[model samples]
Target: MAHKKLQRFQEIKTFPNVFEMPENMAQRWTKHFNNQHPLVLELACGKGEYTVGLARLYPENNYIGVDIKGNRIWRGALTALNEDLHNVAFLRTPIEQIQQYFFPNSVDAIWITFPDPQLRLSKAKKRLTHPRFLRLYQQILQPNGVVYLKTDSPNLYQFTKTVINLFGLELLQDYDNLYAATNLLPEHTIKTHYEQLDIAQSNRIHFLAFKLNQTLPIEKDVELKKLIEIHGTD
Candidate 1:
């Protein structure tokens, strides 16, 4: 690792708001925030712009940014500490192991911001919107809890919508051109570094929010698989 990254890794260890493989964390986030506020998770939270931004917007709900990279987490954790954002925290761990850390129905909502599109069919399972990953999310998410996705790739946006339809998941909002809307929410206008870069490159940013109330069995859905295999090429 670079010198700066090593320094950040060491620094994050000292932050009381940051946890690395903590135990007794399941359904116990209320103790961390010192209130019974609902918890929201930002997965694959690179630099945690969403975590910091949303925490500022809604202090009533606690926010935790989860990513395997300690260096990226350092920025958000330190910012929360410095700003005295009590509702903000960072979890340094792989998103795949989330069930081990959080109990069922512990989370109120999820946000996956600007994640890699995982454009290839072979890498479909790695996409955060993939059924396997959704199942992992549902394990800890409360019933009817929303999972939000904000991304620069149009492919991921459409792909997630298709998956939601095929799996009978509720599609609460679908903004193909999120910024084009006349009445945009505050969260929609909060741009991340990647979002700014995408705008400069003329790549459209997409947003999708849905509820995973029912089971999403990708194996049984032949049509969805073929759709992925076909449309995943672009």
Candidate 2:
């Protein structure tokens, strides 16, 4: 199984712990690439298609793929290691706990690919773009940094768009059909594993890109906490 494969990879090399104090992040991260490069994170990076592809595309930036499932991220980590890619790394942790790891304004950008929709109304807080996660991202992402979401779920696409609009944040792009347009740049045209699967099946891919507006007045944190407590029970 995938989990077993990940466990094997974990045994080979212990991943650095990012959940430590903020002062430690630079030491840990910079040890690999130093401070001159920008940092990018891929949340819920399943199989690491985007992480690997992007790292290949942007050698000047450092890429880190964060996911709780070690098995899921093993492919990405191994690929980076095998390719001797100095600019890409993998972090094994829950995406919700991301704020506890990085310092304020530390990351330059974020890519969220095929995240779960958490479709039920009661499960809204669990969505990656929900206010709680957004706040966490704000704490780590640089002021002008952006978050990119690519998925096949229409509900999630609409829900995230609505949230961005309600919060008065800028929506740079809302592509309901990304591949239909002819002007796609090479950087944007590279596909993830899931995206490739979808393409082969002739399915439309939805994408949203938005910048982080630090000045926006976010609602109380208690709302998300309450939602998590009420709906997160297994």
Candidate 3:
């Protein structure tokens, strides 16, 4: 297993569809994809399921899955190559440094699918929907761009709702139980490995779609933390 992982890590470096902590790519996605189509990102995209899936679904838009695990990325990158998914790519890097890879207003949309909930109060800042990451997302996302969060953790689902309410973000859609909804989109039905594992045991998928139309003030984070401290104990 160890040797195979090492081999995958080394092999991905050569895959034309994979970029590992590359430099000077902030404004070059269009050039790399050789088109002006909209660019969407799936952060922490383990195995690039959503990346390859979305690319297959929406051939017009480009998709890039961002994750730190080169070994895991090999699976999706190879699959995309085999299927000739020209619109799919994988970026091996931490989500925190996402801004470094794309220029301001370059990304059209972001999908946070079944990410780590960071349930601890102390680690709240690490949550993808936390203000810290939201600030980074705002830097790279277009003004009209939207963010989609799909998770099985009830805690994360509610936590994100609190952030949206407190930050005054526009909540475009919210479904506590996505599969239970009468109206469902094809993209929403794309399930990841984590989602299949049912690790949370919540027995339901939560989905939230919101726009960062309002500013998320740094001072507001203090209030956000306080709220988490109060209700987080449960």
Question: What local distance difference test score does each model get?
Answer: 0.86, 0.75, 0.93
Q: In model 2, where do residues sit more than 4 Å from their true spots? A: 6-9, 12-23, 196-202, 214-234
Tell me the tens digit of each residue's lDDT in model 3 across 1-234.
999999999999899999999999877788879998999999999988888989999999999999999999999999999999999999999998999999899899999999989888888888999999999999999999999999999999989999999999999999999999999989999988989999999999999999999999999999988887787721
Residues 1-234, model 2: lDDT tens digits: 767885756553554322212344545787766656999999998778788889999899988888876666767777877787778887777887787667788899999988877877777778898777888899899999999998877767777776676567789888988878776766567677777665324377778999879454546444434543554421
Instruction: Write the residue-wise lDDT of candidate 1 on 91-130 in tens digits.
Output: 9888889888888988999999988888776777788998
Pairs that collide, model 1 = none
Question: Candidates 2 and 3: which is better by TM-score?
Answer: 3
Residue 221's lDDT in candidate 1: 52
Ranking by lDDT: 3, 1, 2
lDDT for model 1 comes to: 0.86
Off by over 4 Å in 3: none
- Off-target runs (Cα >4 Å) in candidate 1 are 199-202, 232-234
What's the candidate order when arranged by decreasing TM-score? Answer: 3, 1, 2
Q: What value does the lDDT take at residue 66 in candidate 3?
A: 96
Models 1 onward score TM values of: 0.94, 0.83, 0.98
Q: Which ten contiguous residues of candidate 2 have the minimum total lDDT?
A: 15-24
lDDT, model 3, position 162: 91
